[model samples]
Target: MQARHFKETYSELLSLTDSVPERVWTGILIAGCLALPWVVGSYSLSFATLSLVMIVGVLGLNLLTGVCGLISLGHAGFMAVGAYGAGIAAADYGLSILPSMLIGGLIAAASSLLVGIPSLRLKGLYLAITTLAFTVISTHVILNTPEITRGSTGLFLPEPNFFGYELNTPQKYYLFCLATCVLFVLATLNIMRSRVGRAFIAIREQDIAAEMMGINLRRYKLLAFAISAFYTGVSGALFAYHIRYINVDTFGLTLSIEALGMIIVGGLGSIAGAIIGAIFMTLLPEAVRMFFELFATQLNGLFATRALELRGLIYGAIIILILRFQPEGLIKIWRECRRIWGNWPFRY
Candidate 1:
């Protein structure tokens, strides 16, 4: 069957309407996700919840690096700000879950100004290095401020309360994360479809051309940073609650690199790419561990001793392979499959 578009007018052609298949697929996915916790065990549910949190953070990076062409290496620093901010609010201030998360996100957005303003003049590698420096400074500050963040000792978070109900169970937390992830996804989609999103894309393609076309580079770039930071901050807050523990060491440079890899391997500038990439990367380590466990007798404890190194090696290799063969990322493969299915039985 060959799918055909028979729009009679330009408006119809340009409308962002979902085809029947797309709508049906989306509905099925939603149903499956909603039913996942009941079918899966606690460990699997925990993994899915973590994946959702990463999706939020990765989506933020996609907006900045993918859509706006601004490379950042201090994303984890912003996450730290959010996590600490939310942790302080919930733990020390006695605020509920929702308010603490919002406060954390807002504080992260404000802190982004420190780098966003500098981004007005910086580009490419310079901007990335500048962000990296911010991350270093952020960790130092968090570690030094023993009174506030408890320094290297770490901060403990209480169970999140939603409308007086304590989200103590893994299933409840998973549902909360899913709902939050869906909201952020919708927000990102809306942003990408709006004038701001167009401006970001224009800047990404050519800043000078965008400037000539009357786009305010200063405003949009800063806005991008703020929005991206907010998303990441909320993600950090979720992470803090998910684990109920956090320290400066938690938001390390490696975590930032991992987030960057998620966007790159998922497909830059695509929402579906962010989601797919997060899930794939999140599951990769677990898959490796499973393989090691399956071959424990043959390996004779070698994997147990050098698990981290082996995992990193395999992860880097897979990323390199993906870059070599599918530079456009996994989303490209998905689209190709969908296209093939749509055009099945029509050789021409």
Candidate 2:
């Protein structure tokens, strides 16, 4: 009876959304996203749109590292592959942005299999190093093959269009990214409620234990890698369109490190964490820049230059502070807030 009760509880926890409140709140959030572009200024709209892109990419990383317990350092390489793939397809082959993005995602997924098969077998530092090598190799190939990618000179992307409509304005592009983000988020939510998601969690907790329960370790790990790569690739394609430019330096080790930081700061194994982390990281640099701009006049020129140079230092400091104070991340703070309000009039 106890075992049955525990099983029932576990199953209930596995559902995508269990309460009417959750559904209602989700609806409200989606509605807000739909209405945001009409009210915000062009600059704010663009920032928000880019934030949504980062959310999608970080979500993919969450699935792999957070949920599946796979350490990857080559995600930027996958994004580069997607960005370049879409760029080539749209510029050279005259394909629409949507189809080009899909092609990019598919190509990235296929490429993941090549890396995942051999690398997934390794764990910890070995896996990380292997993926890092992939990044290096990818960068070298793109730089050497200048005829196709335009090499270090960079490649310009055409504006994205949908069914004969061009998304030239910031507002229109916001809507496009907003809609795409919603679709991907909903798809990820459903996946997290499915058997595959459970398999990922089990593997994250203990691969040996998961395999003992008859889960195919290699198969699921590769699937996780492929799926994660697909999401990141799609984001990359959109990024190329968003920035209208692509270069070998654009998707480098630092971007990969930032993606990892987004997941870590958000909270592993939680979708909300991924979203929160994306927003936080996306806005942080802007915040820093604004601070410098506001105070640059107050400081000496050399001091001002040093302040700007402290960009890396500032970012590292913030991450360290967050890890030290809230290792579980901002998601835990969110949960606490909900718990406090959800049980209003009663003290915990």
Candidate 3:
């Protein structure tokens, strides 16, 4: 009876919007997001738009690698598929940005099956290699297929429009990206509380145990890949629209690694972690560059060149420190802070 009561209490704690303070904070954040475009300049708005797109992409990856224990190093390739898919539709079919992006997501989802099926039999590092190979091959295909993907020359896309309104300016497009990010993040949170989410957690912890409990390993694993691909693909489509150009080189292996780093630094299997990581990783490099520009005179000119070269090394050091000290990521730190505040006036 005590165990049953404990389980119920624990479940209540896991409720998505249970706490009044949390709900209040969420509302405030939403209001701020809605008002941000009016106050921010174009460059900041553009940066925020890119951050939102990355947040969506990272959430999808968290579902796969974080929740389902699927290791993939080919995420950028999937994004490329999405970008090209939407670009082709918008260019060739005269479709609007909204519908074309959806089509791009669908195309990427379908393509994921090709990799998912073969790699299902493999686990861990082997599976990672399979996905890596897929990314490499996908890039080559994009580069060689000049007829379809425009090859090395790249494809230019018109500014995205919706309901007859053009979203050419960064401020206008910020709203579009913001809406999509909010919707997708909410969807991902709901999904993490559902039966499918439970199954994913099970698989991640112990696949054999999950199979014994009647979970279909094959189906769910592929589903993870497909859904992750869909999210990434949509981000790619948005990227194409945002950049107004598409090239095979844009979504490279480095981009895939960055996505992985987001999940790692944010927290595996955590939706909040994905968002936090995406924001941090996205802004960190830009902040560094800006700092260099601002301090170019105070620091030697040689420092600027070295800073650019050492960015990767600094990024690596940060990740290592996080993993070494707080492997659970920023979400854990955030939770700890919340817990401490909640326990104020009482020493545990």
Candidate 4:
């Protein structure tokens, strides 16, 4: 095979090269997802839905920490706000799912201002600690406010009703989540391609140089927080509805850490990385469970009580190994494979 290039015109030059394969693969993937619910068991369908929801949240965090170079430990706190916001709107106000989700996202974005504004002057460990404090404070508030949030008892959400249809089944909810995930993924890609997205990358590379280039650090930073929070909030809303029950502990520090890990493992600042990372992390626990199950008879139930602990240990080890050997993340590995395939039969 010989490599060919066609660039006779400016438009042709600007257009995507070798796009047909990409389109074909994307179409196949989409079709598979659409047909997945009918083919898979209920548990698998539910797992897929959870993966999609996490993808939404991870994409938001990627925009903030990965693209904008903002460090946040309060992602779960923002998610809690969104969850409670949507939960309250639907449970109490009797609003529909769409409106409730919108309100939740808006509320989360507004709350992000409290942290975002202060973050303009903070960086690195200091910024991380600040966000951590915010998470602690948010958790405290949620716990104390029993009347609204239902506190430690948990809040029960009504069945998600979109228009006249009720998303009562796992398959229905999964489809809803899949649609939402696609929209957010597309939105993130567009944002990264736009002027604001360029500014975000510039700030991430070198704030001082970006400022010298007339980029407004404070404005873009704050905007990043707002947008990130909105994405997370909607994700929270979906979560609340998905489970139909949420407590403060549901959106705890563990979730924030997992979101951060997803971005790191997937490849920071890459949209596809976020999606891939979310899917991988979501399925990791199940993989661990399957491993234990496979050796259940041989282990003689020795690891039954310690499964959770072992899972965490294995998870940490895998992350360390990936960081040690492939610091660029799983996306780098993906790119390398693609490059090799594209250059098959010849090494340049």
Candidate 5:
């Protein structure tokens, strides 16, 4: 009787995965998201919130590199635009947080248009170099625009709100961030599985061939940039609100590289890969930090400050190792595991 009951439960759970419609799956995901903060511990909820924000950045970069097949080393500049915009709108303009975020996203998207239009015309290395140049320009602009960004001093942001309630607690903030990230992810999945997604894949596979097939390169390419920039901007706005502070140092070239590292390790061109990348990269540092704290107690001195430098070296080396051994990344390995499990009986 117990064996029968266990089989029944397993079958029921597995059937949910097979029988659920796409729309129903979305609704279920939404329901789960709403329940997450309540069910999970506060610390875990906070970590999930940060992971979701990282997902936003990863999604944007994925669109640019994975979909559009355009590499950008200046994505962090787009993020900076959103971050500072949120800060200024929240503090000086005294705007609502929702509108502040929207404003930041639109402005970031618009700014990318200028960068994308011309940069898209260039091919390969030239295009990457152009984007990198934009990063340099963005740094200079932030440093010089003291009247607006306040230079290196940074600015504080107003508290986020919903229905006149300040989302002051980590739980509240986590809910908002998680909701937005999930929304973005769902929208991205829908878009990627649509006609535009096909065009993106076509272009990625071969731009000239895609153009031959009647896909408009300029329009789609710009669309990719605009879409990507929009997501990054939203994430940046969320970051600003969560931290409630902003400066030039917050967004830089290092962040851009980190984004690349995440997508590469998680799986380039896969949304699942992007999310996996974000979670791993964001949490890994925290884990490393904890190790350093424990190590400091044992090693007694000098190790605490030196630990950060060691962390950087470790991060770089690990990335290199992952690329060398598993260039297809974590996503490919995940898919393989699923495939193997599905065909387990054939193994005999």
Candidate 6:
């Protein structure tokens, strides 16, 4: 009786998910995203902006790791190319924010192509090692290349504006970031459902088999890097403008690994996962740090000493726990709940 009941419930869950049209699901997501800023507090909304920046990065990482089956241990370098590129354009040339962002993204993409072309021929660990080397080299190049990057001192950027209005306030910047995140996520979702997405998945599942099935390995591989870098670069560029400044130290291996971790924790090959993961990772650190500081007086030495170390310890512990269970990530849990609720009237 128990086995029969479990099978019936599982069948009902599957049936409900399939019942909802894709268009409807997309509409609901769009509406929810649009409503976030209005519904959340200002501080929370600002963190949402930070998540927005992270979201763009994770989406790109997803393309490389989730779809293309390639790993980039040094994507932070690409992001640096983009951030500095955009920062330079606005600071030096007096270009508008949008144009500066475009130039920055272009610079990152071009650099990525240079790295991808020769290095992509290698697979798995070899590819990762090559990118990691590029990352280390990129950091030194930016720090020492004074003619362009300006060394340890960070560069300040002009406030972003459209015509008359400058996006100078936290609220205004949040709105801008929110809109961009939505558009990019939509674009990502659309891509994964299209022809290029199919090619990417083919490469991911089995590159040799994909090549045998008429997919050009080199062409698609480079294309993935180009696309991924452009997204990360543009976001990096946007991040420079949004934050009001940038520096060589801003782009580091820690950020590169965190970007990868966001996708991993969020769930690979899932757009919803990318978003949820970014939000989780972005907010968790902030919340923990703030909580410790806010209660330091009341908690005394118990919470005050070595708080930063505690934050890292907690984060590492959570990662291990998440991997042990809920390996598909937080989004999968949300979807499961939705499925059960959506079919409550007739649970088999």
**Per-residue alpha-carbon lDDT of model 2 for 279-315, expressed as tens digits?**
9999998888787777777775855568767776787
- List candidate 6 segments past 4 Å from native: 1-42, 290-299, 345-348
lDDT of 6 at 87: 86
Query: 115-138, model 1: which lDDT tens digit per residue?
Result: 999778999999999999989998
Position 99, candidate 6: lDDT: 82
- Residue pairs of candidate 1 with colliding backbone atoms: none
Better of 1 and 6 by lDDT: 1
Q: Which stretches of candidate 1 lie over 4 Å from their true place?
A: 1-16
Task: Write candidate 6's Cα lDDT for 1-348 as tens digits.
Answer: 122234346556443233345559767976886788779887877777788888987898899887788888767998888889988888888887678877988888898877799876788889988888878888888888777778777788888875557887777778777777878887887788677999999999988899999999898899889889988888898788767878877888899888888888888888888888888888888877887788889876876667778888888888778867989887788788866766676555
lDDT of 5 by residue, 1-348 (tens): 022233446556444233344458668877887888889888777777888888997898898897778988878888888888877888888887788888888888998887888886787889878877877787788889989988888888878886477888888888888878878887888778788989989999999999999999999999988898888888899988887888888887888889888998999899989988889888888777677777777875667567778877777787788889889888888878756765677743
User: TM-scores, in order shown?
Assistant: 0.95, 0.93, 0.94, 0.95, 0.87, 0.88
Compared with the true structure, all predictions reach lDDT values of 0.92, 0.88, 0.89, 0.90, 0.83, 0.82
Worst 10 residues of 2 by lDDT: 1-10
Best candidate per TM-score, number? 1
TM-score of 2: 0.93
| Candidates 3 and 4, the one with greater TM-score | 4
Where does the lowest 10-residue lDDT sum fall in candidate 4?
A: 11-20
- In Å, residue 4's CA in model 1 sits off its true spot by 7.4
Best by lDDT: 1
Comparison by TM-score, 1 against 3, better one: 1
Model 2, position 238: C-alpha lDDT score: 89
Measured on C-alpha atoms, candidate 2 has an lDDT of 0.88
Cα misplacement distance, residue 136 of candidate 5 (Å): 2.2
Q: Order candidates by TM-score, high to low.
A: 1, 4, 3, 2, 6, 5
- Clashing residue pairs in candidate 4 are none
Q: What TM-score number comes out for model 3? A: 0.94
| Local accuracy of candidate 4 as per-residue lDDT tens digits, 47-94 | 899999999999999999999999988889899999999999999999
